[model samples]
Target: MLASFDIGALGHSFWALTISGLTYGSIYALVAVGYTLVYGVLRLINFAHSEIFMLGMFGQYAALMMFGFAPQGDAYDMGVAQTLMYLGLAMIGGMVVSGAAAVGLERVAYRPLRRRGAPALVFLITAIGASFVLQEFVHFVLPKLTNNTLGGLNAQQPIRLVSPSTQFTIFGATVTNVDIAIVVSALALAFATDRFINGTKFGRGIRSVAQDPVTATLMGVSRERVIMLTFLIGGVLAGAAALLYTLRVPNGIIYNGGFILGIKAFCAAVLGGIGNLRGALLGGLLLGVMEMYGQTVFGNEWRDVVAFVVLVLVLMFRPTGILGESLGRARA
Candidate 1:
């Protein structure tokens, strides 16, 4: 792959790749938070979380459809105000769907198992099973319900809410309006989440529970509520990410769309230190940039391999990750 590589192209598109990488990384960071938060509190991977992200994608699509948007034909060119309004509604729809799915998963699958004092293996199996069930439900059942419009094994085209018009240029790279919206909005949400996790009474409860559930429970923190809240936050972020993702890949919305991204996001969480929020952001940006650079150097076909290789090398050196796992120390 390296033999045919155009090294000069890498230099020429350095800024462009970096910008695109950051955009992709922002989405990864958003999704990674869901994994990290759930892991921190429950010490479980919550494998079904990816499906939650997938559901968010459909939720936003469905919302737009309800607003008179269609899968194909001429793209909508509504005024800026109307476009933002529709986008906002779509995001809210995504959040509600993803949040409800997450909570339901916990209540129906994990919570009952936890109450029964099930082993770690049982929880892991259940999570994996739940993930498949959700995906298949979307794949086989949802398409039928939407008259083959929203779901199924086929990829659904999202209504183009934001046209990717070039907004600015930096260091020879042209940035689009969608790029700015995705990066800025994702950063804002990440910052707000960090603040909420570190600055609120509920945030304290979450950290306390993550540190020690028994002690936190004794101290009057409701474990169930904290778990629910963590899932809700994760879902909301994922929902927002779904909107941003649609902006990036309008034709890429499908049941399996979230699978690879979800894996990458999980990799990002581990790369950043699985339980660390700031680490997820850092890891995501780093991974995205590195993956883009890898594509430039190793060719597009090797991009995914390069990403996983980097992950392995990082783990070989620092298993705890770049910042280390410490939900408790995050506030400090």
Candidate 2:
């Protein structure tokens, strides 16, 4: 194992891997926010959140189709302005679909349970079941609904809006336009979310509910409204991330595509402190960088192993996570 370790490879590709890692980390951070927000408010893991991400992929694809951009073997040659307009439209479609689905999920699957005072275990099981149901619906039912024009066992033929071309070079790493777009867009969204959470009346309500729901309700905060808002915000972010992810990996929009990525996002939430927003971002970047480096040094097969190993170590030594701050108690 020592002989097989390729420290030199890591050394040579350090900057390239870092850029790649940060790009992926941005996506992970966005998805992880969904997990953290739900956990902070409801104390539920929301195992189905990943499926939300998956649905967002299809949502964006559908949006592109609506704009007369059909799935094809190669990217269309739409000029810069037209491409941006369609991309923005697709993102909006994704956000709307994902946000609606998340709200509906809460209404259909969770609200009744909440009313019945279901146990945490029951919620967990339901979340897992919901995950499978969503996956199979796309796998089996979506094709039927669309007359096999979309959603089946195979990945959607990619509708590449942006072909990654080298835009700049930094420290021997070539950065592509897609990389820049993904990172910058993710950061802007994250910053906006942070500001909204820490600087708005509804944010205060969310925090109050997370800290003490019974007291917050007594104080005139509508707990149900806060919960719905949390789900909506998280889902919208996931939808944005889904579009960015497709930009990076054009062929990644499959019915079950979000499973592994969703698990990684969940791990990111746990690694950064399950309820802490900033922690989720930090953990995702770190995890992405570490995974890239590990893949370089220990071979591609060890990439996932590194993420899990890091999670296990964190749990063993610092279960509270890196930041160790809960969302409710976090100061502005």
Q: Pick the candidate with the highest lDDT.
A: 2
TM-score between model 1 and native:
0.97
What tens digits encode model 1's per-residue C-alpha lDDT throughout 1-332? Answer: 36557778889999999999999999999999999999989999988888899999999999888888877744688897998899899999888999899998899999999999999999999989999999999899998887888788778865888778898899989999999999998999999999889998988989999998998999999999999999889888988888889888888788888888988888899999998999999888888998999888878888888778878989989998888898866453
lDDT of 2: 0.91
If scored against the real structure, what TM-score would every candidate get?
0.97, 0.98
Least accurate 10 contiguous residues by lDDT in model 2: 323-332
lDDT of 2 by residue, 1-332 (tens): 53369999999989999999999999999999999999999999999999999999999999999888878888778888999999899999888888888888898889999999999999999999999999999999999999997789999999998889999999989999999999999989988988888999999999899999999999999999999999999999999999999999989999899999999999998999998998888888888888899888888888788888988898898988888758899594
Whole-model lDDT per candidate:
0.89, 0.91
Give Cα distance to truth, residue 298, candidate 1, Å.
Answer: 0.5
